[model samples]
Target chain A: ATTRIFGQARFTCLILFYVLFYGTYLVSGALVFSALEAPIENQIRLDLIRAKQDFLVRHPDVLDDDLESLLDEVVRASNHGVSASRNVTGGPNWSFGQSLFFSSTVVTTIGYGHVTPLSQPGKLFCMIYALLGIPLTLVLLSALVERLLLPATALLRSLNAALGHLYRPFTIRLVHLTIIVTTFLVFFLVVPAGIFAYLEPEWDFLDSFYYCFISLTTVGLGDYIPGDSPGQPYRPFYKIATIFYLITGLTFLMLTLTVFYDIPQLNLSSVFSSIKLDED
Target chain B: ATTRIFGQARFTCLILFYVLFYGTYLVSGALVFSALEAPIENQIRLDLIRAKQDFLVRHPDVLDDDLESLLDEVVRASNHGVSASRNVTGGPNWSFGQSLFFSSTVVTTIGYGHVTPLSQPGKLFCMIYALLGIPLTLVLLSALVERLLLPATALLRSLNAALGHLYRPFTIRLVHLTIIVTTFLVFFLVVPAGIFAYLEPEWDFLDSFYYCFISLTTVGLGDYIPGDSPGQPYRPFYKIATIFYLITGLTFLMLTLTVFYDIPQLNLSSVFSSIKLDED
Candidate 1:
């Protein structure tokens, strides 16, 4: 009974820790993004206002407050990504190349939603595409991760052997996990972000890193899409490449997760299940 | 060797069927949503154009080609959801209630990207928030699904006992699955959709259903959002409620998937794994 009570206390502590850790993470993220984006948003607002003022000055006869308000409305619409000019010069979003790219994003559940289907047929196709694609993508990614796990497990076993005399098994496993996670971060997040930052004229490193994190986690807020910039060379090729990058990145993420879960001590599912068992 | 070949053929067939089935589902959804949204989008577009033209006509002095083009640009911006008036009147999007709602959406991977973090601090907080919130949400959802599965399995077993003499176990299981899936659809999808349709002025039943499906699947394209309408009563409360609805809806979805995966015949993971083993 004492041990059981102790176990319950530990479980509660774990829960609390989990909540606290995540809360801090979120609040910190909010603070950082607020700091970064507020200035840019303000700058954009100022530029929009200045642009409107400039246009009004050029057409002094129509410089009414109402016109200024209308101009503001128009600029706001453009910011929301509803520019008619986008439809005109931006080309068809659902073209074959773009559609394939879109399909991949939908199935993977990335769902950038930057260039969504406009027409009834396109939207219908998109839904159908996702229905099939998501499962298939899952199956494929899981298979790939399963195969990758062999090497990962082998590495863990080797680490176990290497450190058996010097460290606890959990410690060795933790070290192994750190290595795998670092590799994932370096190869997937850090490198790709650098490449993207270089390629996307508007994006700095932070934006690219943010994009990488958002997409890999499948949050896909669509705030920063690649290859949408005007005069982008080989746009289709770039999109296709990005699609491959996303697929590979997702697979690696799954692999990392698989490794993380393998370390049962760190696995929340196991901990939570044990707590449930204790409750029963 | 023959058995292995046969297994491979069967596996391929299963994959094909899965693809076809999901494709049909998505296509039908796309068709329905397309029919629903196209007219509305067109109407909005026409209205925007007409509004611009009227504004220009009222101010005959601003009737130059340049002014008309500027007006077009403004109208287009408005369409993209970037109206300055929205920022001015919509208040800060990162308010406590909205931030909580946004946090929930991010963790759940239903990143609508409608009201994204604008400041750097906000963006950083968003990333950190997602890093931890996502896994925590997953664990929570999975635990809920696991608990739900016991009753679900019990129900299936009872069905098996009731139908064992009359039908094959597979058939009984299929029936059980159909019932569970239907219940999930009715309870999570249909009912909430009805409520949403009632609440959201612009969304018809189909739109609401589409929103539910997109959200439950975690696609979250953000084409439609709730509680954004002007003069929404108890807006914060409504947003919080929607957040809960999404969480619960996702939990049910996981339950449905758990049930689906329990059926070994329909389990792609097992089939694919076996295929890998056979190849090895």
Candidate 2:
């Protein structure tokens, strides 16, 4: 009875700790994104207003009683990534290169929807592509992660041997996990974000990082696509490279998750099961 | 040597079969979506052009040679779901109900970026919310699936008993799996799609199904969102109900996957490991 009670207590405490940790993480993200995006959003708004003013100055006769409303409509649409005038020309979104990239994103379950298929056929194809591609991607990712796990395990074993006398196995494993996570953050998040911030004229570091976080987690909101800038050189090549980056980054993410799950104490699934045992 | 050869042959056949199946599925979807969306896209284009022509007629002075260019730009922006005029007004997207719905989407990894966080604070909160919410959602879904599996297994056992003498165990299990899959499709996909199609003015059955499938799979492309139309009756209530629907649908999805994974013969992970064994 006492043991059961103790187990229940621990489980409750762990749940509480998890909630607290998650809350802190979210609040911190909000703070960081707010700081980064606020100034940018304001700048964009100002630029948009200036553009409107310029258009008005050029054509004063266009300014009627409805001019304010029309201008407001234009600005609102721009904020939502739309424009009022239809003259802005880019090639078809479903060009071969773009289509292939879109297909890759769909299969990976990223589904950015920034450049969606307008035709029914395209939408249908997307669904069909996703059904098969998702599982295939899963299998491929798992296989790669499985391969990576061998080396990761070897590293853990070495750490265990080196610290077996000085520390508990759990402590050593946690350290190993931290090292792997930091490596992921540096290579996938930090370095790539820096490159993206540099390459994309409009994006700041936080935007890039947010994009990375969103994509890596497979949330893929599609608000901040990398290479859609007008007159971007070698756009297809850039897109393909981005695809490769996503594939590799996803593999590393899975590898990190594999390592995290290996530490049974940190496993939420196991924790929940144990809590269930206490109830039973 | 013979067994290894057989395993390799099987693996090769499975890969080919998977590709063929996936390709066919994608092609069919393309065909369907093409047929459905072509007319819609055309109608939308026509309406946009009309809107622009009307605006020009109202302000004849605005019709310079540049008017054509300006109109085109406006149309192009609208096609991409952007707008130039900011006069159109609606309630804030992050209402208490909408925020709750958004939070649900984020944690589930559906991430329909259609209605994203514009404010810095909102974006930061979103990231932090996702960081913790995802794992918690996973834990909750897994626990629910685990419980469901008991009854599911019992159902499988009964099927085994009834079919053991006439059919192989593998055949029986496949039949059992088919039944469960059908149930999931009926309850989660078909029925809900019917309801959503009825509620959303623009959505047809296929669109609703696509939405459900996309959301459940966590692809969340965000082309079609529920309850976003202006002045929809009981908007908050509808949004909350949609949130519930997603949670339940996701739980059922996890259950279906659990059942699928329980079948050892269909296990891709194990198959890969066995192939590795042959290589070793």
For each candidate, report its DockQ versus the true two-chain complex.
0.31, 0.27
Residue B9 in model 1: lDDT = 61
Leading candidate by lDDT? 1
Model 2, residue B267: displacement in angstroms? 1.2
Deviation in angstroms for B245 in model 1? 0.6
Look at candidate 1 and tell me the lDDT of residue A185: 98
Q: Which 10-residue window in model 2 chain A sums to the lowest lDDT?
A: A75-84
Model 1 per-residue lDDT tens digits across residues A184-244 = 9999999999999999987989889999999999999988888877677888889878987
Q: i-RMS, every candidate?
A: 5.0, 5.6
> What tens digits encode model 1's per-residue C-alpha lDDT throughout B1-280?
7775576566566555654664454444444444544454455456556667777787777755766566554553343233445334554455566566667779889898876765566667778878877987887777667666767878988998888999998899899999989998999989999999999987888778778888888988887788876677888889868977898889888888888888899998776688657654
lDDT per residue (tens digit) for residues A1-280 in model 2? 7875576566566555654654454344444444544454445445544555666677787754465664445444343233345543434354555665666678778878776655555666667778877887787777667666767888998998899899998899999999899999999999999999999987888888888988988989887888876667788788878987887899899999989988888887776677657665
Cα lDDT of all candidates, in order? 0.72, 0.71
Q: After TM-score superposition, what is the CA distance of residue B188 in candidate 1 from its true location, in Å?
A: 1.3
